[model samples]
Target: MLANPALNKLRQQIGCIEETQRRFSRTIPVTEPVDRWLPYGGLSTGCIHEVKGTNLASAIAFSAILASRLAGDQGNILYIAPDRSLYPLGLLSYGINLDQFLHVSTRKSQDLVWTAMEALRCPQVSSVIALLSGLDLTESRRLQLAAEASGVTGFFLGHAASAPIASPITRWKVSSVAGKPGQRFDKPLWTLDLLYCRGGRPGKWTLEWHSQALLPIVPQLPAKQAAREALAG
Candidate 1:
């Protein structure tokens, strides 16, 4: 018996698709707790993710950490925003390699999105952090596709809790959690809510950001407040 030509062609196509998926599905390693919680050990590259919160500082901090980790020492990372509000020095605490970091500030919102989409398509760019006020499903899908093409990780930092965009692989909502009275100078605390994960369950956690990793901390939320936030998430 001989193999049919059509069957051979179909096998070749399937092999190519599997190879593409394996290439794009490589994940950036994250710390414990969060790492164990994630279906994968860490976030998958070649995908768009969103971080939202009332306190932009906490959200931006988290995004910076992820971007820095994704870019490592040699890869490039682009930060796109309306203004030059994200100080490079501030990101130093997050272990960001300033030499590999670039910030592109645009006055118009549309320009910000356009710049991010272009950056995501750049093979030299390992990650892109875009501060977007709002993004519809269409725009989100475009960014997602761009990342897929270049195997770059993209982060969207949204100001408020906007309508959930469908294209992102995961959506996280963060908020500042007050620490002990005299521990203000200690590590800042934040409540991280995994609002929506494409392949995982939603949950909440208290995390303290250090120079190297995200360590789980004790929850500071009251039972009632925690319940409300959980429901909202």
Candidate 2:
């Protein structure tokens, strides 16, 4: 006797549901606080995120925050810098240890994208950051597939004037905010806009460089710290 086609479809659906549940169960929590702003409360392992900005400083700052977060305790970050050099000192100023990060520079944009995909497939790499002059749909799809296979987060950096291609789970646009001129130290201020996201709304928010702790500036400190400072005062 032949099996019923309806039963086969039902079984397939059940199997798919079970596989999705298992995958979600195995997902590791993102180790960085900044990730909370992203959909799913953090960067998903198998997706591509795009960063574009008129302000180079803002773009770099955003990328550094994501990279540092992904590095966590023992993992390493791979940065494919195509146009500008990866400033170790600048990363350190943002409280990121360049020692835990590897910078791979390529002269051409095409090479950078290919290198980024290859690096993402490396099991030892926790995350991959690719600074690209531009990315088309085909390239984005290729990177996305690689990221999914390797369970690595791929960050694509594009110029503000570059044409937008749709492959990113999330797209962000950053801009520089005016800063106080007379301050003792000059720190860059940035505004991050969530241009598009797979499962979230688009909005704009402000962030700054931490002048004291050398970390990405957040709006508020932990509640415990706030309480402690209040009691002290």
Candidate 3:
């Protein structure tokens, strides 16, 4: 009898689960919490998410948060950067431990994409972050396939000025936002926008890295300011 592909995949997943359970000796949550703005609660396993930005720092900041969250207590993360060196200090500020992560540098964009796909296929790695200059439909599909095969999460970072719309499970755009000058560090403020999601609506929110926490900035006028305005009117 011919082996059923579905059954084969099920068996593979069961094996993976058993291996992970044995190594960790604990049950980890299946879904990691992203932003409430994200649809589907968080990114699903075996899926590809794209982050686009003109500012490299903004993109890295967003990806770092996802990586740290998915890494959990003992999970491992792999990062492929083709544009520049992965700054340990920046990642530390974002609450990611450089010592606990794998950083791979590639020469070309194509190599970066392929390496990311291969890393995702590795059973030992829980998440893969790929920094690519650009990607077409074919490349995106290939990465998606690898993600599915290994049940790994993939994050693709695209160029800041040019971001082609590829078919990813979720797509986010990060941009600089105005902040109070001289109020604190020289780091720029940023906003994260959910441009496209397979199972959620599109929305935008401001974000700030403060006191080692990635806090979402709620936009609202102060109550005292509103009251004073009302009295003046």
Candidate 4:
């Protein structure tokens, strides 16, 4: 006898639930040094994550890269926001595939929550990035549950507001910093703050999200052995 598709899906979801019940769930692998500071040394899945931007552009850029990395090979992204200024060419320049992104807009903020909730529950969807002004803790919790039930990740992107809202698995704040001036194609530097985490302490780091990798932006140092030659010159 053949197994029912619905039944098979339910079994898969059950397995996912078992994984989430553990102290550490699956995370997207990262190669940067900052990985150690993250909850599990990587981006945790099956939970609602918040990314607050100092400005919209940096937020979108930061979130887009993360969404792309999370989606991986076959998953698609559902992005909900009223702002339609998401430039396809720019995203392509940033190494995000244009075809994998689906943009949805809503006039009502309540509709935004509902749409995000539904998207989070779709197994095929890898990530949901919702740009909203405000969301009560109750609504946000529903989204978090949906994410776990579907084994997907959720990112709520918004401007910094007076927040006393739902506790996400992880909360981040990002702001753009000045990059090298004369280099026309220098990647943007960002100040990243770990505002909150489920079981980790909050901290900050400076990183540059290059198109190819997430690199910690560290200061360059002169080689000690070569310093004497520099002084003699």
Candidate 4: global Cα-lDDT? 0.78
What TM-score goes with each of the models? 0.81, 0.72, 0.73, 0.81
Best by lDDT: 1
Stretches off by above 4 angstroms in model 4 are 1-24, 162-164, 219-233
In candidate 1, list every pair of residues with a backbone clash: none
When summed lDDT is taken over every stretch of 10 residues in candidate 4, the lowest stretch is 179-188
Model 3 per-residue lDDT tens digits across residues 36-134? 445444556666878888786778777777777777677778888864566777677666877669888978777877788788788678788887766
Clashes of each: 0, 0, 2, 0
The local lDDT score (0 to 100) that residue 73 gets in candidate 3 is: 70
Which window of 10 residues has the lowest lDDT sum in candidate 3? 24-33
Error of 2 at 30 (Å): 9.7
> Taking the tens digit of each residue's C-alpha lDDT, what string does model 4 give over 78-182?
889876877667766555777898999987888888888889999999988888667787788888888988887888887766463587888888888778766
Ranking by TM-score: 1, 4, 3, 2
lDDT of candidate 2?
0.70
User: Roughly what TM-score does model 4 have, to 2 decimal places?
Assistant: 0.81
Pairs in steric clash, model 3: 53-160, 54-160
